[model samples]
Target: MEKYIQEDLDKKIILLTGPRQTGKTTLSKMLNPDYDYFNFDNPDDRLGLQEKSWDRSKKLVIFNELHKLKNWKSWLKGVYDTEGIPPSILVTGSAKLDTYRKVGDSLAGRFFQFRLHPLDLKEIHNFLNPGNLEAELDKLLFSGGFPEPFLNGTTRFYNRWKKSHLDIILKQDLIDLENVQQIIQIETLIQLLKHRVGSPISYASLSQDLQCSDKTVKRWLMILENMYIIFKVPPFHKNIARAIQKAPKFYFYDTGQVIGEQGIKLENTVACAIQKEIHFREDCFGETKKLFYLRNKDKKEIDFCTTSGDDPVLMVEVKWKDNSLSSNFEVFRKFFPQLKMVQVVKELKKEKTFPNGAEIRTAHNWLSTLTLP
Candidate 1:
C-alpha cells in the first residue's frame, strides 16, 4: 500500500481513509520527511487551514481530518484547480472521505482514494515474515491487526486498548463526523454485532434490543460503517436492490472486538482478510469487486461470495475443522457451475479438491497468501 500510494501521489491527490490508528498518518509522514501536516481536530491547525498557511515549500501537504471542514470538497477543489500537484495533496481521515457528505463541489476526477485496513495475515507475513504463521494467526485473532496492539502482541494490552479505541471512535469521531448522539446505544449496537457475527443482521432485532426504531438502527449501522467500526456484507442476489433489502451480515474491523467461540472468530478473521483483498483490488487496480455472503430462503448458505461487476466469480466457505465438503456448495453449483468454490478449514491435514472442482485449503496457509479471483 505504501508503494502504491507513493506512486499515485505524484500524479493525483491521494485521499487516504481508514480506521483510526491503522497508521494512515504514520504512513503518510513516512512517505516523505519534508511534509507539512495539519489536523482539523487541532485548534491551531484548523486556524492554519482556514488561513491557508501551510508551508508551500514542503514536498507534501497532508490535511488530516479534512472532511470535518465545511465544504471541504470545494476548498480542496480550489486548491487543486489553482495550484497543481507540486506540493502533493494528501488528505487523511478516519472516516470514509468518499462517503462523508458535505455541501461542496464534487471531487470526482481530481483524487484517488485508498482505504487502509489493519494488517492482515498476508500483509504481516509479507512484511514481518513470521516463521510460525499459526502462532501469528492466534496472536492476530487475539490482539487484532491494529499496528500498536498487534506489535505489542499481548492480550492484556489489547484488552485495555480496545475500550479506549472504541470510546474515541464512538464518543469523539462518531459524534464529530456523524452528529450521532446515541453513544450508549451505539456501544450496545457494537456489543450486539459482536455476537451476531457470521449471521444475517436483522435491523428489527437490533432495534428491539437497542429500544429504538428499525430506521434508527439502520442509520446507526450506516454511521458505524462510515466510521469503519464495522462493515456489512449483503447477501448475494442478481437484483442489487433485493440484495440490499435482505438481511446482511456485519463484521468488526477489529477482530478482538468479536465475542464468540474460536470458530466464530475465525470466520470474522477470514471475512476481514477477504474484505482487505477486495478493497485492495478496488482501490489500487480500480476493479469493481464486492464482498457478500450466499443464502437462500431455505437457509442453505455459503460463507462468502465475491463478484466482479454483476457476475458471481467465487464462493468461499469457512469451517473450524470439518474437512468434508459442504453440501451447500452443491446447492449453489447448480445455478453457477463455472463459479470457483473453495472451503478453507483452520485445521486441515491435507488440501484436497473434490470432483466438482471445489477445493479444500488450509485456512492459515490460504489466508496468508489470499488473492482475489
Candidate 2:
C-alpha cells in the first residue's frame, strides 16, 4: 500500500504509529528493503538491541515496538548522538512512543509523527481500480480496511482478527508499554468507550464507575489516544464562549476497528465515510484545514465544519436518508449567511443546489474531486 508519509521518511526521524494491524510494519519493510530489522516482540532481537549500542554507520535500522522497553529513549539518544548522519533510523509502534514514560530528556525535536488511518477511499483507489464508489463504500463499511480481514472477507476471519488483536494489545502491548495492573478495568473501559464513539467523554463519570480517580482515568485515556486506538474531535467555536466546552467527542482512529469490535451500524458507517472524505479533501488541497462538528447553546448542531484559516469555507451535514434537511441547518444558515454549501451524504442520489444558494452534492462525487495537486 502507498503511504502518505513515505516521501518524508528519510528527511525526518519518522514515527509511524497506528492501531494494531494497520500495516505499519509492512510499510516500513517496503520503505527500507535493505535495512536491518529488529522487533521488540522477539525476545532474542530485543535483548540483542538492548545489550549492544546503536552504531550510526549502519545503512538503516528499523526498531519495531522498542518503546515498550524502559530505556528505549535513552538508548536511542545515545545512538543518535554518536552515529553518523548518513544512516537513517525508523521506529514503528502501535502505541504512541512519545507517551512512553521513559521518553524523557532525549530525542527532542528529532522525530516527526505520522498517523496511518484505516483504508480510506483514496487508499482503496490506489490499491485497486477506482470503479464504483457505492460498491467501494459497501466493502469499506462492512469488510473494513484492515488487511487480513478485508482480504479474507469472511465473518469468522474478521471475528478472529478482532479477538486476537484486542487480546494481544491487552495482554502484551499494555503490559509491556504500561505498568497497567488493573487489566480488567482497562478492558472494561475500552469496551465502554467503544459504545460511546461519537459522544463527549466524561473522565469523572468513567473514573467513578471504574472506582478510580479522575486523573487516573485521564491518563489511561491519553495512553489510548497516544496508542492510536482512539482520538478526540474538539468543537469548533470561534468567539462563542457559550459554545460547548470542556468535553470533546471521541472517535476511533480507524472506523473499521470500531465496527469490528462493535457491530456495524448505518449511522456510524455514513459518519465514517463523510469523515474520510473531509480528511482527504484537506490533505489534497495542501492547506492547513481541519474537520470539526458544531453545537450551540440552543442545541443546534452541524455534522462537519470544514475551514481554511479563520474563515468557515464549508459546513457539511451527513445523513443516511435522502432529501432531509434539519431545522438545525436553517439556524446555522441564519448565523453565517456566507456559509453557502451544506453537504448531505447518502441522502441525495445526485448533486442538487438549494433555492437558497447552498450546493448539495453526493458524497462520492465530492470525495473523487479531492486529488493532490
- TM-scores, all models, native as reference: 0.98, 0.83
lDDT of 1 by residue, 134-169 (tens): 888888788789999999987789999998999999
Q: Residue 80 of model 1: what lDDT? A: 95
Candidate 1: which pairs clash?
A: none
Winning model by TM-score: 1
Measured on C-alpha atoms, candidate 1 has an lDDT of 0.91
Best-fitting candidate, scored by lDDT: 1
After superposition, the stretches of candidate 2 with alpha carbons farther than 4 Å from their true spots are 1-7, 51-58, 101-103, 204-211, 239-245, 256-289, 309-311, 333-340, 355-357, 367-373
The TM-score of predicted model 2 comes to: 0.83
